[model samples]
Target: MIIVITRPDFFEGEAAKIAQLLQSGRADLVHIRKPRASQSEVEQLLFSIPTELYSRLVLHDHHSLAIKYGLRGVHLNSRNPEPPAGWSGAVSISCHTLSELSECRRKPYAYMSLSPIFDSISKRGYRSAFSADDIAAARSQGLIDERVMALGGITFDKITEIKEMGFGGAMILGDAWR
Candidate 1:
């Protein structure tokens, strides 16, 4: 799957246009990660998108809106490490280390993003935590699989490389937005 995460800051005037374009294109999922936005702001953003596209969105904050808006799922990050009690829809998270990935495999997530597979395009100086060799080794050891997606600095050119490294898919941010 090709997932696209929204930039943390709201896109002043182009948010709806960009989101609609992505929804009409190849993005399998769109993770809305507006960390500083209020619940009302998030609701407004959601309202701007067509209701038919609601099933393709995943909210990073105000998860209650997932049910309120009938979104595809909710993404757990540092802000929310676990799903609220009785969250029955799809849930996913970010794993920074092999250990976390291993643990996530035991959960019922649709997929998990294992990030910084390459230097971050959005975050300066955020280098990859694992090398190609490390990725290969992890795959060999059964740590990387179709449930773990590669994130960070992902461009069209890197998709094949990420697949070769045994990631299920790539999550596009900077590359897609650019």
Candidate 2:
């Protein structure tokens, strides 16, 4: 299960690219993370993609769009910490620290993303927060398991290590859109 996160800003042909990813099976899920876009703008983007693939796309903002379009899920971030009222479908969240990851164990989330495992390509100077030793230790302690995904700076080259470290999947942002 490889999840692809969209860029922060929208660009021409972006919807087509997202559709291609889903249609080609290149991404099991595509997270639309446009934080500043208007609801209408996001709807326009959604209208461009095939309706059948809506279930493979998750929204970072305008979660109403997710419910309206029957999207895959909603991603919780600092901007939107809770799912929409009565949202009962698949839900995921971002966790930046190991403690946050550990704390998420009791939640009923579909999965949780633990990020900054490597230097970020999309955000300059956003370096990795966890060392390999820390990751190994977390795995041995049963904190990193099949419900966790490695996000930030993920690329084709690191998928094997991510799997070996006990992550269920890799959440790709900078690497996938590049």
Candidate 3:
């Protein structure tokens, strides 16, 4: 489960190419996290990608488009903490703390992202709140497990560490773009 998250701001000429390449490669899931994008904007972006790869896409906004376009699922964040009624396909969420991860695990989501596992490569000044020891302890205590995917600042080199920490996978953002 190697996941790739889209940059918040769309890169006019490069985003589609990168996304297609990622989908064709090892990314098991691709979270489309354009928060400021309108429905039309999102649609346009989706249109750019090949229809055959739509099943790998997970929407961070305009979730209704998931069904319309046959996307993978919808990702729940602070802005939208729950799935809209009638959403029956795969779902995912963002958890910033151990407690939130614990709570979200009880739900039937495909997976969840435990963010800031390392200092953010995309967002300046967003550092990890959990230490290596903390993650180890959490894994020992069963707090971190197969359903938890490490997010934030995850480069190719950090995947092994994240797996060792008991995360199901790594959700890449900046590293993929860079």
Candidate 4:
């Protein structure tokens, strides 16, 4: 199912609302992508979530913390090559190009996100380099995985179209909850 990983700056102080949204099935996965949050902030937010909902939540760039907080998994940035040795859990990575996609395939992570399908308001200075058709072509070539998600500039209105383009799901920002 398509998921919405909340960008912290936008979803600040809305963890409960976010949790409620996820719990109510408005989103499949709620990945907390807060780059500047302190450990305490993360801990507080995680603690606010009900355990029964843990299976559908993920943290970003904080693998150890996610484990400590009893979260489901983490979404790695492109910079991290692999999760620490002996770690056994669901781990996802962000990949923006075909080469990155090829590299992530060799890793043992559970899934990956191919992003900036369109210029995103959240990432103001960046522009999308690939068209949805380009992504579709790559998928057709069997370069991406069935678990791949299309991120950047995605909105609730675009979910159907993104799914139609063969993406397993979408990662959105600055849309509904912005």
Cα shift from native, residue 137, model 1 (Å): 1.1
**Tens digits of lDDT, candidate 4, 1-178:** 6677776664455767777778787788888877778767777777777777787888775567766656677777744445655556688888888788877778776777887887886778778878767877888887654678888888888888878777778887677476
Tens-digit per-residue lDDT, 19-62, candidate 1: 66566776888898899999998888888787888888899999
Sliding window of 10 residues with minimal summed lDDT for model 3? 14-23
Per-prediction TM-score? 0.93, 0.97, 0.94, 0.88
- Those runs of model 4 whose alpha carbons end farther than 4 Å from true positions after fitting are 10-13, 78-81, 84-86
Best by TM-score: 2
Residue pairs in clash, model 3: none
Flag the better candidate by lDDT, 3 or 4: 3
| Higher-scoring candidate on TM-score, 1 or 3 | 3
Better of 2 and 4 by lDDT: 2
Model 4's C-alpha root-mean-square deviation from the true structure amounts to: 2.1
What lDDT would each prediction earn against the true structure? Answer: 0.85, 0.90, 0.86, 0.75
Cα RMSD for candidate 3?
1.4
List model 3 lDDT by residue over 9-75, tens digit each: 8887655665665667768778888999899999998888878888888999998999899888999
Whole-model alpha-carbon lDDT for candidate 1: 0.85
Best by lDDT: 2
Error of 3 at 35 (Å): 0.5
Error of 1 at 140 (Å): 1.3
Better of 1 and 4 by TM-score: 1
